[model samples]
Target: MSDVPPIWYEFRDAVYCGEFQVAEKMLRETPSLLHMANGIGETALHFLAVEDDQRGVDWLRTKGFNIDTKNEFGTPVLFEVAQLGYKELCAWFIENGADLTAQDRDGRDIGEYLLYYDKSEMADWVRKLGA
Candidate 1:
């Protein structure tokens, strides 16, 4: 078993719960754990995607986390936000220089994948971002 620190688990849970302040504290105290993922290969950003917390996303970006980082299943931050139809978050991510053309494990581009998943609005948003 890998000897991951307790703060790593706390950070993941905090992220999933949208507790940005706690997550930030944990991250600041243990910067090395910022890149750690949870049981499903979800990094802090993946949890933030579900939380849809723009503030947390901005904080993470400021902390130097890679916006385009993918989980083990190859799902990028944009993919998750798009799937959830979070237009503002998706637009923010695009403005911050996320790769619009990145593909997932199935080799589907972000736009195509969103449409395939019946997220037409998000697919349209992706198109608007020039994906």
Candidate 2:
């Protein structure tokens, strides 16, 4: 929010548009962009998760970014994407070290959200994982 760099917007636009190659090129030139958060502390990982780009997520993780990076509200990238009902992604996150028990400032964990949004199967799955 504070005078974000023009390239950051370009980078975000590329990612949002599903142009991972272009986004990767931009990041290659501006490596710090990987860790740069927006006004609310959301990073490129958040966008990639929303896009369901597992490869992109893995790429970011290989670059040393925490997959559990939280936004200002304490919502992790995995939690944000769980609402979309991507069961495979949910499984991958849990298998790859995502914290299923992570909660937001509202005291809501992934299971609470999955159940709230009628994702009973996902809720049940995460519940089994100790969410």
Candidate 3:
């Protein structure tokens, strides 16, 4: 069996399935898991963004989750959502003061990365935001 903890899988599954209640319960039980990483190196906040779970994202932020944190690939929270065409999530971060021009390790800004992912429309929008 994998040495990974059982709660780890539970949390990941909860986020994957959009079971915010289950995820919240797990966080309530073991609050530190909020910032803990899964096997693939995604924190609970990352999953929340991936799912566009606004409530979960807000709850995590209230718990002190760093919105500026990077994933295993050095993708920031804002960039991750923007690349997914999550306009609401992108606007939330941008309006809330995320660096508009923050680049990944490869030096690709948000617009460039969106274009790289073939999200031409999103790239245009991000560029319009001057990010």
For this target, which candidate reaches the highest TM-score against the unseen true structure? 1
Which has the greatest lDDT? 1
Candidate 3 lDDT (Cα, 0 to 1): 0.77
C-alpha local distance difference test of each model: 0.79, 0.77, 0.77
For residues 1-131, what per-residue lDDT tens digits would candidate 3 score against the true structure? 66557887787677567687887788889987866876556677777788887666766677667777677788887888987888988787777677876788788888878888888999889777778
Predicted candidate 1 versus true structure: per-residue lDDT over 1-131, tens digit per residue: 64556676677677666687887788878887668776666667667766788877777788777889888788887898889888888889889999987999899999889888888877886797888
For model 2, the superposed segments whose C-alpha errors exceed 4 Å read 12-29
By summed lDDT, the worst window of 10 consecutive residues in model 3 runs over: 34-43
Q: What is the lDDT of candidate 2?
A: 0.77
Q: Which stretches of candidate 3 lie over 4 Å from their true place?
A: 1-4, 9-31
Against the true structure, what is each candidate's TM-score? 0.83, 0.77, 0.76
Task: Please provide, for model 2 over 1-131, each residue's C-alpha lDDT reduced to its tens digit, 9 standing for 90 to 100.
Answer: 47667787787777667687898788889999978877778787776777787776766777667888888777778777778877677677888899876887778888887777788887787778666
Query: Model 3 reaches what TM-score against the true structure?
Result: 0.76
Sorted by TM-score (best first), the order is 1, 2, 3
